[model samples]
Target: MSFPHVTIEGYPRVGANRELKKALEAYWAGKIDEAAFTSTAHSLRIDTYRRLRDLGLTEDYAIPADVAYYDQVLETALTVGVLQAGTLDEEFTLCRGNADTAPLEMTKWFDTNYHYLVPEVADQAFEPNPERILTIVREAADADVKVRPFLVGPVTLLALAKGENPLARLDELVDAYAAVLAALAADGVEWVQVAEPALVADLVPADAELAALAGTAWTKLLNVDNRPNVLITTPYGSLREGLKALADAQPEALHVSLAPSVLAEDPTYVDRVLEAVHPETTLVAGLIDGHNVWAANLRERAEILDKLQAGHPDVAVSTSVSLLHVPHTVTAESNIPVDVAGWLAFADEKITEAVALANRDEDAFARADRAVRTRAESERTRNAEVAARVAKLPEGQVQREPQFEGRKEAQAELGLPKLPTTTIGSFPQTQEIRKARADHRAGTITDAQYTEAMKNEVAEVVKLQEDLGLDVLVHGEPERNDMVQYFSEQMDGFISTDNGWVQSYGSRCVRPPIVIGDVSRPEAMTVEWAKYAQSLTDKPVKGMLTGPVTILAWSFKRDDVPVSVSADQIALALADEVADLEEAGIDIIQIDEPALRELLPLRKDARPEYLDWSIRSFRLVAVDAEPTTQIHTHLCYSEFGEIIDAVAALDADVTSIEAARSKMELLTDLNEGFHSDIGPGVWDIHSPRVPSVDELTELLTAALKHVPAERLWVNPDCGLKTRGYAETNESLKNLVEARDRVVASL
Candidate 1:
């Protein structure tokens, strides 16, 4: 049952110990020199390869050295000279846009949590950067470890890129890639993994033409003299028509994901792939799950492999995708319950599972079975009261009273300004705020002292908003660590870890709370802060809570329950909090659901059911609010084209979305008869840049074309927790002034 080969597609970018994140941040903040940062990255690269070697994965199989300076896509851009200027500062600007410059467009990395900077291909010439690739190869060589170099395939890079005729320069880009391949061969490398995930996406005729162009590029790359054996890896979903296009490239091997693909649901999908692939090419069966925390059912995986091996006899085994999505290891977690820990597998454990499956180790399969059985018997999987409550829920519990017109009439009683202005819930979490929370956690500050510090911050934020003439105010959220994690800490049935950090974006990591059992709120999580902040201002303060769907989307929930069931429990908990806030005289409540779109199922067929329950969960939280009270929900970094129907079904009084980065392009999708009041963001808050009043006015004017001026609100794309006070103040001031001008014209 043993396969001829075993290889990992790639490893995580965050170092095994997160040394790279700390090093990169320190380097950017001018706390360290370039030499120190390079040394740290080099050491991490060497350590990664050495660890893989020590774990019995040799260079002939998995080399474990495809590391990124920041992100693989960014590194891919650097490889092919996509940047107009190749300076480090320009590189930084591309990844993190500054005050004067907008960064490259960012999007989800093919159904995974990782985000990649899209390559800007306008008027850029291609050149090979073999020195950068060689540096990592040599670092592995210095450790006496031979390695396989990884590259984002030409087809995928061009497919995910922006600009006119991105694939028009395909020939030149292929030449550059061929030179890189020849250089790798000269350095004594034996294999290269070229990732082409675009093959799994739904492509139109124009995109199919680009895909064919990519195939031509790959053909040229493999034709390079002394080129290494190249394996084309396609993850995320099944490749159908695109597979036929890629077959013309004639690679030495092809790797396809099985876990998230159609193959997992239907074994007959193997036959379809076999028909599409080149008969002579080696087929690498991706068997292990890479995106989830659950351990693979080894027995079931073996049966699936049996079907694939019948058609392709020399099948190699691998993880379904890169293990980068999961955390590094579970062995370091001592506080987690033993039974729950036994049921889980992190990236390190997943690697071992892959190797075991390759070797057909019976003991590993036996252990996996026992862990699955143990989890079934654990009390963490069952909650009688929660189940009973869910079963008895009334049919109309998710619908709010009196519709949008009545709610709008009640909202006018507050006498807010036209084109009302507000932020997306949080102000900048400055160093003083962070330090105060840290001091409180360390037991160095009394409860009274911490409360006073938080109140002072709230007062300052209230004054700042009033000075800017903002129509709405927020409590600044200075005491919270993360939107989801902050509430998870206060609720029952969740576990928080001190060191369970995972990278969200550049230099920013989140410690997602683990939901182990039935979730419920013991008391109001944000009421005290909301009341205190409202007491400081005559202006209406928006009481904020992270939406149930977002809390469930971000956290690692118990595997036994359906995600809908867990989300329902969270919705009920948040429903109680919403009622408490309304009773406390907080008329405006914002439930933020930024992660809703990110959690959509990659397969189109699987999306409707997920969207149905996810929308219901959001509705269950805000359905009971009084018509006089304004209910707001925020969704950021989402593509609203397909799910705008489900979004309208939530029926919040107001929904603020992230649109500034796309310059109101998302408004086109929203023109299809949406029910709620809409607020397309006026400017990007993720960047440190302060938007000028003129720029804000231009964006607001664009929004007016789609939304009635009376129904449109003005705000930033998301929270300002990651920004600074100076920029936040300037941005809000400009935002209010732009709204004022727009209102005057109206």
Candidate 2:
């Protein structure tokens, strides 16, 4: 039992200043050498440990050396020797894919917004690769910053594997893990944090198979010779019946989330967790919320810590989930209002809270109590008009009127072609576009200058789309910063940060807006841009907007109110924008709900409530649109099988999804239950490799079997914002050519 009083499963790997993001992007672009990239990672690793140590976390397993060079799951896959990549270039290809090999499929890690590279174990071998994690540990050791090494647990890695049933490979995988453990032990490591999130990710009342699987995996791991002390962290809790399996093998310590959302469904949750753990095993109470930025209710957390620590043999305190979900520090954000910043706690601040609770610091408790209380009591958190609108929201199932069948004919009146070609809202965000945006925000460029530059870019994009012979087009979104952040900036009751960058997926960072109070649109977001883009071309240009559910999902939402209420408030704001877009003569509007499936409750019992509110919030956005308006919604990168019915229920005239990466696998599920017009993406926008005309044609042809050629829209997997113009131009041309050939053949 060597775990520290305050420890985390992992720290934020993206540097406080986003050093890792810059380094990785530079490496990917070939703008930097391997030595330069390695140096940057070395610095980031040292910086994380030093920063955590300075912020009241003790040395020796207190700071987990979770240096996610790209992604933690990818790191774990390498450690277990499952990913099978040989070189740095090959490893990156496993993440981003090349001309031949498609990148591993990525989905949201559990219910959080962060996406993890799913392990491809269908036809892969398992062996130990200790060099990756060990190298990082040694790097930290050289800096005299002792830290714990972290890994995804054997059971979890197998549980989340794609393409094949990996249960049979458990014994083999455990052997590989054992080798890694032995290597760490020989390297003078004292402890390791193994994340078994699978145990709790989809916890049920009782799952005999899962329990047995976990029981066997833990038994093998703990029994391995020369193993380091194991701290098995079942983060993002709701362990429920899964606790018995974990308790069977008394680990050095166990980490569990006490956040209500995870630990719900039982009044005896705390008691059950305490009871389940062996008397010798330390109990690490994950009482502080790690997913959101709100300051911990130290008073309430102290009460729980007091119960856990009072005479308990070895008790510590920590966060309910990894701090990776949150930004590094609110202190880095000089632009955020002082009053709002006071209520928030980023990764380092959260760790400080954990240390305080562990040490039973009363002064810290008093300070946190005041901050938490002030947020509750503040008038700034509430708005009368926003409250009135939320109250007036229509009751019942809230389905939109004149469903897809009725609107299909009205939409056909516009006479769009078969296999209509379009992008998923944005074109490549060039350096010029980024600079203009930055300059405008920095006050170096006047409003007129920025607007003119954006209009020029939009016109260029429209011309490019026209040249590519796309049936529909986009304004290219040069004026926007992020899909969610752009909308949050113009709305009331949201705090947009200047430097609060958290990793969304590999080197792609987003400053998630903080939803502070009741949300309302001050004027219209994206209306003038839509109107101007439409004015440039007679062809329909999509009036792009991020949907309400997505905006709420992406933001650090208010803890005081239910998240559903926040979604509705945002829906109302976006509804106003949708109306304005429609009034501006932009009929082909698309409100992207890409995070729709991201926020689905992990538990089966809890999903109905989430689906009801989330789907209604989406419908409310487009419910007021005209029949011929053709409101299109795009969802991407998620496992949409779970929400196919809900996706159809959304009742958008058309729904485009991330189908390319999954090779139209969703079409099978969609064909069974879905009724609306569908777009199964033909191009994988995340990768640098462009799909050939034949590849796109093949994908479009496959899609036509499930969805009619007329209903099947051809597009890329997601927005082209992260891509470059050269790749984007070539890809669009191939995509349109693919569509033309398919249409001609039909």
Return the top candidate by lDDT.
2
The C-alpha TM-scores of every prediction are 0.92, 0.93
**What tens digits encode model 1's per-residue C-alpha lDDT throughout 1-746?**
12237777777667767998999889899999889988998888888877776665763637645678777888877876665446666777888877788787778887666788888788766877877778877878777887777888887887788889777777888888888888888988777788888877654334466566766777777777778788888877777656776766778788888873346444556777777677677788788877677787887778767877777756777888888777777887888777778878877788788888878889999999998787777676667777787777775436788888888898888788778899998888888999999999999999999999999999998988988888889999998888888999998878876566666676666667788788888888999999998998899999999998889878876656678888898988898999999989899999999878877865566788888889888988988888999999998877776677777788899999989988988888884558688888987997788999999999999899989987899999999998998898888889988998988888
True-structure lDDT of candidate 1: 0.80
Native-structure RMSD, model 1: 3.1
The sequence of per-residue lDDT tens digits that candidate 2 reaches over residues 566-605 is 9888888888888899899987989899988888776677
lDDT of each: 0.80, 0.84
**Model 2: residues with Cα > 4 Å off, grouped in runs:** 27-36, 83-90, 97-103, 122-125, 131-145, 203-207, 264-267, 310-312, 467-469, 671-673, 687-698, 722-746
RMSD, each candidate, Å? 3.1, 2.8
Residue range with the least summed lDDT across 10 consecutive positions in model 1: 201-210
Q: List the residue pairs that clash in candidate 2.
A: none
